[model samples]
Target: MSQELKTKAHLIYINGEWSGADLDELEVVNPANGQVIGCVPNAGEVEAHEAIEAAHQAFQTWSQTTAYERAGYLKKFHALILEHQEELAQIMTKEMGKPINESRGEVASAASFLEWYAEEGKRVYGETIPTHTQNKRLQVWKKPVGVVAAITPWNFPAAMLTRKMGPALAAGCTIVIKPSGDSPLTAIKMVELSEQAGFPKGVINLVTGSSSKIGKAIMENDKVRKVTFTGSTEVGKMLIQQSAHQVKRLSLELGGHAPVIILNDANIDAAVEGVVASAFRNAGQTCVCANRIYVQSGVHEEFVDKFTKAVNLLKVGNGAEETVTVGPLINQASVQKVRHHVEDALAKGATLLTGGVSLENDGGNFYAPTVLSDVTASMVVMHEETFGPVAPIQKVETIEEAIALANDTPYGLAAYVFTESVSQGTRLIEQLQYGIVGWNDGVPSATQAPFGGMKESGFGREGGHEGIESYLESQYVSMGIN
Candidate 1:
């Protein structure tokens, strides 16, 4: 099954067909062992434009599709995802270095997004407006925004693309997607599923290339009414600048440096579990993963010891191996970035309790899951998005101090608070500027909830009913009474 998946992973899917570009081809390497896995077409401006044109042309008919019909196609897609679960998981693990189990879970999560949106599509209802005129009635209707160009990141490649594409298609919008160059195979394979589910030609397209060239192509195309991107804050800012030239509808899910607070009265075990899961999952490559952990002074000593022990227990190795919990960083550059952050924290007088060094002879871009104590806001790890498995704990004297430290960063993506008191929880909920807040848990949002950011993290929601609404426009119709 893995060999079969590899055969189809090399090509790009454009306008219901698989093909290579006349331009360069990107070498897709497995980060775990540094092996060349496959080569996908390094699409250029021409190919990107081709995809936009195809989606634009198809939107006319696809937008005219009834909600019921679109739901049917989405249901088929959901089933197809499960059918290709193993292969999809392997492709993601090989390409991005996330553990196989994690990748499999991601595929299932991606399918759930499709399933949720399929039913949610039926509920894209608009309200009727009351007017002053006695002889007329005003009714509002939801209409699909035209072509959408979706750009997704590498971490959790399958889920990210599906989360964006699921709702876009459910809202009757045709779309073209540009997956991350490091992990295009998952997106390309998803396109195959979309085709097998009998989507009309041109309704779905995939392009791979220099993100700048492809993003420019997406921005400049007038037919593309909406743009949805999930990646770094730097790139998100760049897209915002580019979108200024043409006022296209936009949804940007960018970087995050989320904070998790451990109050004095919080259950030690539960808080420890949340901290470990959020800090080390996907080797901390996730955007919403916990950044700085603020532990109340009363329990700081015990919390640090527990966290240090947990970090040391994690096994770092190839993602394909079932025993691996913490996998290699995506590539050499990512490893260097993690190393730099750890070194900076240590140099700034933070104490490394466990796992700061990269694996010396691991035969992979592997960095150990690290834990640091006495982390201050002045440290580089606290200020920037480490995007690595390094949990830095900061001791705070009070809830006020914790909130102040948590909200200090420009990012407002997701935050976590562990508390036993209702008053403390209420304060955390109201005071935290993050878009999504988790209480006693690490992850706060899911397929059934609207997830986004409040400040520099980015804009627009991407799940539940609100998810599809981003891809649709409201139209008003008036009828005169005879």
Candidate 2:
């Protein structure tokens, strides 16, 4: 490891106290340099159980609070996030190798979730069921699901934590958050903010550690009423199996091999720009990032030329620099994974249209934004989620062929289509198998919309009113009067 001074503390929060576990301390490295930037307590089964117990205790009172009362606390929390957005962004950049600009955006996105859900807390509605003209009436009620365990990935730490926690808190559910060990500093600081915002003790807890131990503890805990996770499909499958035994409610936002389709009549310039931003932002670490692109045969060659040029021009450097467009992969393992995918694709006969090599920069986990053309369906990069700055482009004869190729992958979290014809765009949108479809743009999600996936990408929705419902359980009551 490079000799960089670590600035973050190493501790885990349980039962409203910062404590050390018997597990080893995990050093947080900056992916841009492979330098130590912080350390977090690598919690084991013991700490995980403690967090669950804390959340369970907090839920006794938290879940009993009025929706209006919960809304007040969330509003304060939202304002506190805004007050420290810059500090949180810097922590995120140091912990995860995201460009400072993108980190700032992540901070803003986190705050938006809190603000949106704060208002939603007061609006959770229950309906009275209509019955036949008799002396009987039926009422329905929605109540918090007690304790929740939120497992988030390192790709977008701040936003992922808030996206899950905001709705859970708004719905009067106490939570235990287990952030990825790779990037836990920002989340730990956010937990500090929760205390400062005057949230009840034990209402929100943070635990960091190895995935296997922490995940098993959360899934096996009978006190945890629900489990929410965002990560790879393989891990998601294991969590689902574990949750099955306990019959716990689960919300999994798993791996995605998103597709981008460029039509013959589309605006090439606009589509190319969208592809560059969508596929390479945060160095293409996002789950919804477009990994597969199918260009209509009529404009495939031209699109490839422009897309390659754009990838070649990206500025790869430290995330702190304002001019840097692409930052390093989150870790050496991630770099190796990207390299493996690229090398496998080339070995399988795909042609490298632009970049296909790692950078010579010292210490940084940097890989050049790469573009591969003449890619076939058989290549690993075509079917798998390459969580890095690698784009695999393929050509299709028509829109029907493009859609067919897009849907060929088992993962269907998100899809992108660029076209000028409104009628054609609507038709394509209706046929796409993805949960979220972007039309003529690369934006996959907004706070006002629902986001999740179909197929193996996992289930349950987040954002908007639907997000709040995930933390609640419904009960119907019927009464008769003689």
Candidate 3:
């Protein structure tokens, strides 16, 4: 029994209080050791409504407050996030089974969003639309869209919450967040800090529960003026349909089967490291995780050898351990899904270059970091989002073939290109069909860039100035002097 396996508290935050209802409770398990670490209260319909109503009421006052005042409180909240980051990181590691290094990075990343948006609160700019006549002026202003319902996923709990909450709070919108039940503890703590920062009552609320019941409640509620969701494409589509009758504003960051291409002229060592980091970080559960690797024919053998060796050397264990390189998948279901994908690929004649099975002795949801070569386009592992620590490598003769294979999937969330030639990188950037592209690098997003997807990957943006626009309603105002 390690410190990471110790039990902890799990309570919902609504209107600045830690309260639990009579609803069903679910155990928050440490995937690293199969230990029950905490119990989260599942939000029933009544409790969900309570959170919505609280947000609705708080919006009345929060929306009317001066931008400077809101910014002040947010700034304080940002400082508090820094003060308590270590504790929050420990909670994230125990609850979600992400490595301590990664967990700490996530906490810091989460805090950065709060700090960035606090400053951005003062910069939500509106403009005077130039009028046709000198005596008349058209003024356009941005206002909060009232109560917001934000549903985030489990992959990056802390960072995802901050990304959605940052813009909503900056725009003066009160929020009722339904974090993924699998990793709800860290989010609960964050809401507590927001309350301590002097935010108005009900301005930020947390509701945890089964996805179907809580998701439908938020989607059907008229009080929730806007919805921001980060999850699977299938669920995102359903949410859009549910919100159709009310025509609620939506921002969805959905599923991704991102592609990474390595040209013959690129640096093989750096490219191998980039692929491994981008693919296996967080156990390859990230929506933006690289699932497809296309290496040019000239360097295909060398790249595969280096990649396989690197992956095989990774250490998998408890997330709280300082030496662990890879942690367990979030749950048993994720483990099974990854297993199925790899098995299917093997059945389809994909060669297992390094690893292909789960580790039995770990007593956790631990799958070995896997690499497969000789993968064809028809293999399931090549097309589907294998949200696990598995990378499938394919050989390509030309850049055109690489781009075509990359864009063949129904998902177009993100893609990466590695090439030494500036001309080749530029060409690939133009040809790749994904929404966000990394040239000669593996970086997926920045707080300053717009992040979203195309095709079946869902719609809307999550960062940059464009993110705030999603929470605003545009009304054209006309004035004339008589």
Candidate 4:
């Protein structure tokens, strides 16, 4: 199966069949070694429309299927995912450069979404409305939103796609997906599994290639009732503008510069562990990663020392190696961005404690896991989302100062706080302005939790009950009796 997947002529999936095999292909390179492992068809605007039309046609029958039937299909797909977990993880690590262990975890997390939404599909209930007049009967009905367009990022390729696909399918909505050009192989393979799971033709469609062309086609199509996207804020905003004319309902999970606060009363070891896990996971490519670290002045020195030492222990190399905790950046552009942030911080008087150099060699895109101290708000790393394994620590004198600094940014995707005091934790949770909060817990995301953001982080939730709700619409019914 692994050999077949690697050698397969991956193509655009539309109307439940593989196609576009003759089109110009886009090479899929391994970020760890810079080898072209595979190539997918470079679909354009015309192909995007064809996928949309397929989804629209399938919705007529798919949306009418009983929720039980939808759940069954989702469950079958979930089982197939588990069955092929190892192969899926390998493909992900080869194409995207996350450690093999993390890639396996991502596959498990992705499978959970299918199992979860399978159950949630059965629970998409409606309510009876209370009427003022006895002669009139009123009710509220829940329904699938219609054909959906899902635009996902490359970070957690499998998880991101399943997160959107699970709910959209279980809600009885047909979907057209546009996976990131950098990592479409995983998406293509999943779509293959969906076919094996017995999903009806056109119920799930995937197109790869130029992002702008495919994105424009998906957004501008009138048949597409909703758009669900997870990517940069700039791209999300552009999608919003493109879909404006059609007034499409959109669920956007955009950018975030999540902040972590460590108070003097917190367990220094525990705080370090949580921050290291949250900040450096996936080589810090996650949206909710600990971008900024704020430590109270009383314990700032101890915290920085422990954190820097912990970071130094991480082994950075090709993700295929089992011992490597930190992998290369997805591409050279990402490496350059990480380098720029580190350079700018050092120039601004921020002290680098460890790991500030690049590990690029023989086409490898590696950067060292770095830590910076004495960072201030003026530094670019402090304000911008450094989507790399770099942690910048700042010392704050009081809880008020810490909260103020954390909330100062426009992004409100996620924030973490480490404190032993119940009062302090409560206060920080209430005062922090973000969609998701972690109280002494860095890895806070779960398949059953409401995951999203506020302010510039973008609106809409992607997990738990809210995830399915995003693909549904409510209709009020009225009846009159003689």
Candidates' RMSD to native = 1.6, 1.7, 1.8, 1.5
- Which residue pairs overlap in candidate 3's backbone? none
On the 0 to 100 scale, the lDDT of residue 184 in model 3 is: 87
Instruction: Please give the lDDT score at residue 80 for candidate 4.
Output: 97
Candidate 3, poorest ten consecutive residues by summed lDDT: 1-10
List, in order, the clash count of every candidate structure.
0, 1, 0, 0
Model 1 clashing residue pairs (backbone): none
Give a tens-digit lDDT track for model 3, residues 195-257: 778888899999898788887789888999999999999998898889899999888888999
After superposing candidate 1 on the true structure, give the runs of residues whose Cα lies further than 4 Å from its correct spot: 1-5
Candidate with maximal lDDT? 4
Q: What's the residue-level lDDT of 3 in candidate 2?
A: 43
| Local error of candidate 3 at residue 243 (angstroms) | 1.0
Give candidate 2 regions above 4 Å deviation: 1-9, 21-23
TM-score: model 1 vs. ground truth: 0.98
lDDT of each: 0.89, 0.88, 0.86, 0.92
User: After superposing candidate 3, which stretches have Cα over 4 Å from the reference?
Assistant: 1-9
lDDT of 4 by residue, 271-360 (tens): 999999998898999999999999999999999999999999999998989999999899999999999999999999999999899986
Candidate 2 per-residue lDDT, tens place, 112-201, comes to 999899888888888899998599989888899889999998988988998999999999999999898888888888888888888888
Full ranking by lDDT: 4, 1, 2, 3
